[model samples]
Target: MSENRQIAQEIIEAVGGKDNIVSAAHCATRLRMMVKDKEKIDLQKVENIDKVKGAFFNSGQFQIILGTGTVNRIYDEVRQLGVTGTTKAEHAKEAAKSGNAFQRAVRSFGDVFVPIIPVLVATGLFMGLRGLVMQEKILASFGLTPDHISENFILFTQVLTDTAFIFLPALIAWSTFRVFGGTSVIGLVLGLMLVSPALPNAWAVAGGDAQPIMFLGFIPVLGYQGSVLPAFIAGVIGAKLEQKIRKRVPETLDLILTPFLTLLVMIILALFVIGPVFHTVEELILAGTVAVLELPFGLSGLFIGFVHQIIVITGVHHIFNLLEIQLLEKFGSNPFNAIITCAIAAQGGAALAVGLKTKSKKLKALALPSSLSAFLGITEPAIFGVNLRYVKPFIMGLIGGAAGGFAASIFGLKATGMAITVIPGTLLYLNGQILLYLFVNLIAIGVAFALTWTFGYTENLKQQIENDSKAA
Candidate 1:
């Protein structure tokens, strides 16, 4: 193999090696990688590779987009290595070694986050529809307000929405083991330890004290329920332990004895060491979050809230997502989470403005319905049909989005529950801050209207008059 091929081979090995791969392809900037199982992919190894930027999966494809200019070379090398749709038996003999701590950590990050995107969207949409149903009195007819049926539905959705994050360490554990060239089942046990109710309370104090529970000389790992790092670290320790025990055990007894011992040792360490360390980190991060929120509200909101729409438009919003989810898991609520709310509102406002102001029947028709959808917290219609189509609408939306974001930030608005629409989403902040979120959404709406009316509408009118004069 050439030098590049060697590098490519290493990259493949890093991403769970050839045996773990099921298929691969590339388009423009991303290598569309697919594994027989998402759990088996080693995200950390892939990310640590030189030239690799970030990895995320969407739909069914595990997308590995290199920073820039490296996609082609990597694509070529992967194909050359026969990872291109190679069968399991073909690469079985060439399986690489399970990676170390860093690699498993990386894998844990990817595994925990990527698969959850679809769920996030679904949850967002479901929440949005819930708001609509409530607003329109669709559910009121059923007498569902805090009633048994309503309570049950709410609980079910909340659990589903929270489950992925709450047990994230466990999820990460499964993926980490797969990446480490072992069965994911072992990682699942470690994950269970991280989130088990029986574990000492990291967030609760025993006896008139502020200190969290300690488990057998180890401080309890409190936030591991929605974390990736703790279990990821635990998996590395577990993998190492499994390897050692497997080596000493007799072949006949190895299968049963190795796993039995490995699970016990790993779980103990997780409870005693890895879990506590992660819990400490969790406490610190949560503290830092509160500290940052204490900054001048307007300035903080003006920057992140306003620019969030642009960030999403540029397709780099996932970077923000990483921050938001972490903050949510640790802090129980995130003040900055309203940026997405601002973004959706901004798009809707701009699209609505365009619908009202535009003379082009086609433009008005397209923007009108989509803008309505955006107001309800569905931006796909607005983004695809209106904002992306007309440069002015998108720009106007950005301006309004920023203004709204700043407004929400200044007021320190928070979503009481997970949702899509600004109104229902603002329930958490209702105490006096609700007014602020409302003001922000309104400002976003007004600014989009004013800008679109002044720019897109006037320009269109000017062209119409000129054409009429010419026709005369």
Candidate 2:
């Protein structure tokens, strides 16, 4: 057998043999397994296995840090050993079984929002480009003024950037409906009604150029353009309402009447009640986030930066994605991105220190590449794999992250984008602030590295070789 296959076999044996595995999945850098009984397996033996970097249990899965290149191979080997594997949906379902109400809400929000993140990423890239092209120097370099730019060119770019936010309600409604077991097409139709041309455009109403039309002579209604919660609530109500309505209708008519009544009832509820109430709620949430960001002298940034990775570890961090999208929509920039970048950088720095200081060759092999991936904005390898395993280095990383986050807020650092960070995030600051962005990364990395190397390292470095020896 190949060396990795040998290691994979050992991994199966180490984890209470193949019968203990209920399900398995792999993300970019870890082998995630949901096993039947915790007491049946030996975590120490798993750690001791050759080619394994680290292991930890999170959100109902025993995740082994196998890195990207190796995880797939090991995962495939285990699957061939005749155990049934699970999908991401199963993972989500498993995660749902384990959290508190707040954690469950956050994970559900992740299930709804993760599908929407890609388009937002694409839009953020365009926002950065728009910033790039609008620069006076760039326009001058191209021998054009703002007014001299063709209207057609401007309109095309505006469509590219604005479509996501303008129709964000539709996307959320669709995804939320899918998650809640509804027919997505009808959910989309209901979502479109919330933003249709027939209603007063929300931005225009807010800007005083238009007014909400009074529905039923007393209820005021306007377009829910760029709205989030109204669509989400509408989707849930519509979906559940459809299931309930379907039971009373005849089977032959069920197909036709179910979706029809679902959309119709939802449209009324959305326009008259859900839209008005949740729009207010969303505004409050947005305002709350703004108030936090506006806190005196970077306290908000420092607090968020320090705890952000800890939030990530809990697997509930997508709650802040709502705040972030709101920030980008209202302010046209996000300082949260800067704070998060610092948190990610600090993780990289701590991992690098672990890689450098450890006398064990296995530690060296895992930590260095994991550190590189962490610097590039993927921190699971560095955090779960290296720093968190060591304990103190992770704490040092939080301190470093806090320092970077405080500096980010004090400096008023802003990103024109969301989602991309560390290496790829350089795109967001290309409008003459790239140097400051790099500087933030440097400060985060330098402080984290210095502190971890200085105090985070323990004398137990030689023990990992015995615990996880390769030449077995």
Candidate 3:
């Protein structure tokens, strides 16, 4: 009777009823279905479903773009229809056959990181606010100096802004453990131990202001503040090790011994080998990322800006959080955020252009909200729900993003945080570069809009949507 249920019912029928489905999973914006036979699917009907944006078969799955909140409801309804065929374990086993090694790895990375995006988004917003509040000129305007501001007040704000990054390893560790079927608490505790007060802060060690706590007089050990790869590797090893140990440990003592042995073994590995090896690899990555950002003629920004959304689509963009953290640690700024913001804005602009151009009420309805979602720093709706469906708009957005990225690099524009973008991103530039931030976003939007308006979205597509709506 309800709209989402009705839509889900239609989708279930179009996918050849429950019998054809092998497994189904929903991401933030898409309903990923593994059907026994692709020939059973009604591709056009799926595309024409009222709120559906697009549909395609890829990686041995029939994936339909249902868009954010909408996907969850439809997913629930389909599950309620008893269409399921595989358990989580079975699905994982089957999924291993769906893609090449690289694709599988990217999907696994997404599985590990996507759930924590909200926390990262919140952290970026807090970082932006801190940048604004700590601006000397702004503070002076309010009859306050850096010294005049209460140290306690500053510390409170710092806690709000810095807690996430300071303990990022814990969050990642917990999530990774959950994904990999390990006990989350042990993972969390192990992460905390990596950044314990007993060790020097990673940033301080990098700055040469603090000495590493030497291990065995040959190896150096320090806290892993603002580190990703180490925590990620540690979590994987911890999870696998725990599962193996669980099988060997006695059932009676399992409760006591499993956790103890898991922690003991994991901690030793994390501190001694995994932590040092991954930390070194992370440093090389950081150095390479910085070198690319500093490349001449803004080539780095142009290329990254154009491809950033594609990276996000694959879900490996979380890896950049490490790069951003390192950049902020070393230089106190994040140019990557500024460049990525332009990419996001371009997608928003493209969707908005489609909203304005489309004659069909259904197209207009879908396009507008998708555009707004993109501007709010969530682009799944715009990218999956609108732009990619139309095709040309997505390409136009990339061009716009490249232009904006070029301008940002030319001016050396930077942000104080990561994750947040577009309107909320304004807070990031509030320290002294708000105008430049606005200018870059405006340029991205303008270029994307102009291009999309000129060449994206054919009249045939508009008429087709109108016809589909009428039939429904």
Candidate 4:
């Protein structure tokens, strides 16, 4: 590892040393660099660096992925270079100017949310499995769901699900603060305010019913619980305001008045303007989801399955929790259950394919259990270790997932309960379509497995790895 670091250092030195580096940031796995000259970067030497997991240059950024902790360590080293580059605001401006729908949408989402995928997945797995146990009556014998709807299992599951979303704004606020170079503590305060139970009623009611409170003379302080947009937008505005304020305000007064005044104004604007605007946007998205799910099961399934991969990639899949819980609350059945199960299973299938394909004994060993974990409806292992390690596997998982989703839709399979495990997930479709759902699921998994094997297990894979080894 030390030797690899030295090699990495040498490569960095070759790439215009500290002068060429414009700015640096890191996600969960990758060290993202904005450089003065991409041409001066030595890709081969960097690849040779020990502990370097992967390298890619895209989106006008040079990325060096070092897996877990190494990314942070490397980020510190890059920061020491004291280079400058375009800020996130500038990046957003460029994206806006491009005006390409898909690219713009993807870039907007990735910028705000992609960095937190690992945390979301970890939290999601806990909630998913907790749902499975309750739905399956696995703990019923032990009084788990003894009261049916009011069971401990249900209560516990709700807490888990709620925690992920309830704190979402805080999470987003923290990330946005970092991106905008603001005091994270201020972001925390703003996030807390949004989620705070002590605030005045911020929800609107119908007809003669109660409505949200208006702040000051005109602005409405809309409730933004379990959301990201409100805090994120506020953080952006606050960051810009903070820079201006910090420059003008004396250092002694800055500590006292700057944050206080910033928070006061940002909160007012967020409540009246930003929060309500995004709330309406979110409602439209929910309406769109409803409209799509009302389509023929086949089409609905296709849409859900296709979006599942996109959602997973964005790490906003948990945003679906509110929808699912609402389905159970109002209709007693979820329309999007099949999409979730199929996506997870697809990930496992891809892992199995990679395991069979890889020449590395260690990777093969890891893939075996990882695939099984995914098959059992736990996909983290497979996703991080196998599918993501090799790009083909992730693509295969998506293909397989889409197929499974299509089949589920065509069959109109509805799960009777919420569960993460494959067998337990079957209960959700118990409205006499059990056989159809099972058949479709088998087809989805089989197709995914076959495709992954064919494409990932080919001699080409071995040759590619061998070539990589030789180059190393």
Give me the candidate number with maximum lDDT. 2
Candidate with better TM-score, 1 vs 4: 4
Q: How many residue pairs collide in each prediction?
A: 6, 1, 0, 9
Q: Which has the better lDDT: candidate 1, or candidate 4?
A: 4
Q: Backbone clash tally for model 1?
A: 6
Candidate 4 lDDT for residue 249: 94
Q: Which candidate, 1 or 2, would have the higher TM-score against the true structure?
A: 2
Instruction: Identify the candidate with maximal TM-score.
Output: 2
lDDT of 3 at 119: 72
Ordered by TM-score, highest first, the candidates read 2, 3, 4, 1
Model 3 TM: 0.88
As for lDDT, the candidate ahead, 1 or 3, is 3
lDDT string for model 2 (1-472, tens) is 9887788888888888888988888877788888888787788778767768778876777889887778888888878877677776877688567747877777788889988998988888898888888888899998888888888998999899888888888998998888887888888888888889999999899889999998779788999888888998998888889889989999999989998889888998999999989999999999898888888989977997899999898887888888888888777798889999999999999999989988777778878998998888889878876788778899999988988888888888899879888889888888777888888888889899999999887676446543555544
How do the residues 18-90 of candidate 1 rate in per-residue lDDT, one tens digit apiece?
A: 8877777665456766666778776655644444534654434566645235677887788888877443323
Order of the predicted models by lDDT, top scorer first: 2, 3, 4, 1
Candidate 4: regions farther than 4 A off:
1-54, 59-61, 64-140, 143-145, 148-171, 195-209, 214-221, 303-348, 354-397, 407-445, 455-472
Instruction: In model 3, state the lDDT of residue 124.
Output: 62
